[model samples]
Target chain A: MSDLTEGPSGRRRGRPPRTESAGTRDRILSAAREEFSERGYEKTSVRGIAKAAGVDSALVHHYFGTKEQVFAAAIEVAFAPALNASEVIEHGPLDGVGERLTRFVLGVWENPTTRTPLLAIVRSAVNNDTAAAVFRRLIASQLLRRITARLDLPDAELRVELAAAQLVGCAMLRYVIKVEPLASEDVERIIARVAPVVQGHLTGP
Target chain B: MSDLTEGPSGRRRGRPPRTESAGTRDRILSAAREEFSERGYEKTSVRGIAKAAGVDSALVHHYFGTKEQVFAAAIEVAFAPALNASEVIEHGPLDGVGERLTRFVLGVWENPTTRTPLLAIVRSAVNNDTAAAVFRRLIASQLLRRITARLDLPDAELRVELAAAQLVGCAMLRYVIKVEPLASEDVERIIARVAPVVQGHLTGP
Candidate 1:
């Protein structure tokens, strides 16, 4: 029943083909990222992604099921580095967690390989509600929940959100909108300037 | 020459009709907002806006010139309240500037009438470079520059961007993405929580 819902390509009962390997899956995901980035969520399609990945459309459906599922997978991979950076909160002394987290997350954005997919997913999420829901789910369950767990207060969730807001907004301006000065400014200098405020959100009175 | 460059319809204008009252101009602008909001900047056209306004496409071109110009006019009206709110930084002592600015900006988001167009413009800005350039120009000149002028430091512009980033990020999470806790929380509560961080960005050492 679930496979039926996963779409027609997944309905086969036999063992998967040798061609349906991990590398192929990564190739499809990479292609999906480029498609979503260039065309956005509404305009991108399974067929389009498959064409870009040099594979059959059925292969894409076999792997990622629907476009929403494909987007979620793409987002998960793109966001993995930043998601892992949530550990900075759990590992460090509480005091500098803000700077550590800020530096690590911004570092992911600074690297072109990571930033490309991240930009694609963010652009997709902002422009389409379905994409936003997928993004919200991953961020909440994977990233925000982890950071929230590390905070001891009852209002810790809200606190984590405010801190997230600070970083996310900076990224939106610096990367997505490409607003001047902020867009061109040095990353280290931005981290230095932004870290304290993030710390204040998490641990300040 | 300028009007010719404005687009084809602007070339025929000598004196606009008596029917082209300020009310008609306003109606066209309002319809443009709706079109941009529903279709985003990339998909929205001056003809679509004119159709929505119950006016001829030529009239829309005559009044607003190009699609970009129409978008700018719509944005100016939608953003006027927030632009006016920038005065808050100047009217009071600098100590609570963060809270005032945060409250005003959030208040704009909290109101549905203003938020609709804001969401459209932001979504458009994120999706298309041309729309983004238009948004960046207005925000940098009309909004950021105003806030920058009020600051006493040499890095006042960067400082303002950081502060803006904090609030902008918060707005993105709360309003655009509709992330919970931040999204559904009381506006006053968010203000209390975020003002200090914004304050720190602007004035903290």
Candidate 2:
């Protein structure tokens, strides 16, 4: 009975199962990022990603319910490290939250691994409304709201939002647009110049 | 024959003629603004826009070739007033460029006519790569380059880029994100506060 149930598949499948191995999931996500970045969201497909990841289509569907969910997961993974930025604010003096935020953001853009995904997101956003909506929701819910919630100031929400705008606009110029000296400057140098402005917005009266 | 070639059914056509009236185009664009704002780029189709505009499907296609071109035209119209921002910069004292720039930008956003499309573009930028690319190209070619080209300072590019970053960052918060009192405060008051900061980036020693 056990042998018959198992068959020769070497798998316990009714509907293929809900969870997948972390390694397999990561592999799919990485491949999906490359595809989405290279082809944009509209051109990318589950079959293409599955082929790139060397996984069965059913397995891909099992892990991620939809293409949008897959893209979301890929972005979440790419941004996972940077998302913990709140911890940096939490650990540091509240007075220097702005500077810390600036440094942290600049640092993320400075690293190629993280910067590429961000650039991909920004580039795709202009023509792809679905991608843009997801990006906006992610930024609003995860980055802006989360950061603002940590601040204890009177206009904390406004200040955090302002800081985010500054950071995102700067990133647009420096990374996505490759605007001159800003694009070429050393990371620490930028942090030195912009940190005070960010700090002021974060904690200034 | 003359009658057949005259009136609404005129047959003297080389390009099939523009079936959409100028008013229809404007009406379609107005509906586009609302659709793009509410449903975003991907979900909003020409059919949807035409239905909203009370026009035929062919008329919509006749006026706007593709969704991308429609967006481009919309943006061009939205930013039409600011195309000659060089005039403002040229007239101002070099030392006060930042203030003028800041004030000019804030004023534009404070106005309802300009603010709606601007918000739509900014909000949609996150999900659409082509839109972001187009937006970046437009800013770089039409706005930033022209602004920076007139400057004689050694690091004029960096200065111009930073000043833009600041102004745009501020606007992103005050308008798109709706951060207050920056969001609700009088435009002139905010300009008075932010202009010097922008000026320092532009013309300050």
On TM-score, the candidate that comes out on top is: 1
Candidate 1 per-residue lDDT over residues A86-194, each given as its tens digit: 7888997999998998998788888898888788888888888999999999988997788888888777878888988889989888887888889999998999988
| lDDT by residue for model 1 (B59-97), tens | 787877799888888888877877876698888989899
Mark the 10 consecutive residues where model 1 chain A has the least summed lDDT: A1-10
Once fitted onto the true fold, the runs of candidate 2 whose alpha carbons sit more than 4 angstroms away are A1-20, A186-189, B1-80, B92-100, B106-154, B170-197, B203-205
Question: At residue A134, what lDDT does model 2 achieve?
Answer: 67
Q: Which stretches of candidate 1 lie over 4 Å from their true place?
A: A1-20, A51-59, B1-21
In order, candidate lDDTs are 0.82, 0.69
lDDT of 2 by residue, A31-147 (tens): 998998887777899999989988776666666758887877777766676777777777877878777888888888888888877767655554466765666666666766667
Measured against the true two-chain complex, the DockQ scores of the candidates, in the order shown, are: 0.70, 0.22
TM, every model: 0.86, 0.63
